[model samples]
Target: MAVHRALAGICLLGLLLCLSSSPAARAASKPDYLILTLMWPGSYCASTQLTEKCCKPTNGEPAADFLVQALETYDSTTGKPVTGCSRSCDFKILPLVNMLDDLYTYYANLTCPSNSGMPHWKDVWCTYGTCSSLNQSLYFDRALRLREKVKPLVNLGSSGIIPHATKSYSLEDINDALVPRIGFSFTVVCTRNYILWPFFYDDYLSQIRVCVSSDGRSIIGCPNGRESNCGDTVKFPPVSYPVSSTVIELPSGDEMAL
Candidate 1:
């Protein structure tokens, strides 16, 4: 009887070890989908209050178009973000040396105290990218590829939605421009320009959040459905800034305001 009990305990331990180390188990723990957030720099810098001071990259001017703000992971079943999946960040910039230019152009770190955008990349990789099935190189590469595929500015311009300081476009106008081109619905986020506050404020187009499949190949409707605080119309401001200008100093707020 004693021998049988000991053998049963060993079998249970082996089973647990096998389950914990299984590839299938690791894949199951990954997030169901990714949200590629493309932010409008003009609107991001226009706010009177900002959590991070905006600045141009030390390398050079970023592209005057929507930039990749974040590529976050979420669980469709729980409707919550999946973060801190791995303790081994082990991030190294050497692996990303080839794509540094594209990363600076599209996924820039405009935050104050501008340095190379390595810190921002590391944070994203440690927080969200580690949770993904992709390795570090593939993770950053995938985001860059997605940004190219979306082409937010080009699609919007094709539908007569060019940026203007004074012009405002309806939500429908923005949606029609992007959805058909991207072939999936996306959330258009807006922020109130508090720079002109106390007198008045304008809802400026901020970020566009699009859902991508786990494999990062095809676009899919956000499982949580469309989310927007935008009114009927929102201004599409031009991306104009002086070199090393003090763009914003908003009060403390959520990093992911979406």
Candidate 2:
């Protein structure tokens, strides 16, 4: 009986060690932060050639620029992304009703055209959001609030990289446009969809992701391994709003004001 008990204890220790070494375990331990990955609607439309898969314009003039696409979490030290940490999303009480409209507007499920914003929000929550120290309301609400803070289009336009045509922009020019205004530097990366995106262009602006601290307030840099892979000369495409005819104006809608 003594020998058997010792064997069982050893087996338990081994099992614990094995589980601790996993990606999920390692990801859970380190300092974690929320990552906001914004996608250009124009680039998505142009690259995939799927104009129908875009979020439809509502309320006022279409937002034809960088739109909030994804919210994920990763380790702050290692820059390793950790997702799907648990099956449960902390969606105990449903989010604020007012946030639902803001969600559909900013956090639209462009990839999943048939569905609403819940899948995108829920998936993000179930994966990275759940892993965070933040609760469901805090997690989702923070995204809406963060959106209010970061507006790259307005800054970039002011820097003379206006949304008109695909221009080859230096890395310095892009960063110069953002850092001064937003007060935080961003990682400018490009799509790996070489076949989908034309070779006539260099890497196009895929995502301008910013890392927010664990408290979900301050912005931090992306993790070490997750730095930008974009070349110096990147194609900054024109912001395209899938429109019937045309309207040229900054996004001026009451929905945006809120």
Candidate 3:
């Protein structure tokens, strides 16, 4: 009985030590809001290089849909997007292996197709999760949890925002269309491309980013009147798979090799 009591005490001390050492255990001046950036695969693939492997259906993925690009936070005081807040701890994604299947298909880093394209999730976790109120494990788990809560893609798709077509949609019309489901102020950013030379054309419907509560529970209002880049009447064009010769650097210091 005495030996058992001593062992129990030792275990408790180890656990306490771990908690103290982890950033999530310590108090932090949390960010004002979370910016959930959802990437439209059609837009992403359109821009992705041919060398990069795009996210595929985890299990007969119904459609080439939206991917969670960056689950970031906005610093109200600094007026800039928060990134690389802390790197004191090494990121270990082994624990997240259980969700590997879903992560690859849903929030993929098409730039890095290796290891089922987990680097995308890793980049976001290491850069932003360290600064979050939750720990490493809970941070990712929360993202997955938050994603399951909304059905914006389906809602938008049902509202005639389908793939392989171009149509002009007004801001008010989109706001009303999504308010019923998303129930929050969100930002819809679009991408434009010009054929160049003899002619020029532009496209839209690149991304739809939504703001989440700090606690990661509810989809909240757009912070500081954050507005979309599109005009009052915007074009919703089909996703383009444009191959870029230049590589872009991700927030986690990762570069999408061209």
Candidates 1 and 2, the one with greater TM-score: 1
Clashing pairs in 3: 45-241, 46-240, 46-241, 46-242
Please give the RMSD to the true structure for each candidate, in Å: 8.5, 6.7, 13.1
lDDT of 1 by residue, 53-164 (tens): 6777665447778888778888888777787677566777767768877787788877888755667888898888888778888888888899888999999999999989
List, residue by residue over 205-230, the lDDT tens digit for candidate 2.
77788778776787775545355788
lDDT of 3 by residue, 63-98 (tens): 356767777776665546655667454676656656
Ranking by TM-score: 1, 2, 3
The most accurate candidate by TM-score is 1
The lDDT leader among the candidates is 1
Model 2 segments more than 4 A misplaced? 1-28, 48-62, 90-93, 192-201, 221-226, 241-258
The lDDT values for all models are 0.79, 0.65, 0.63
Q: How many clashes (backbone N, Cα, C below 3 Å) per candidate?
A: 2, 0, 4
Segments of candidate 1 deviating more than 4 angstroms: 1-29, 50-52, 195-200, 242-258
Query: Considering summed lDDT, which 10 consecutive residues are worst modelled in model 1?
Result: 249-258
**What RMSD value applies to candidate 1?**
8.5
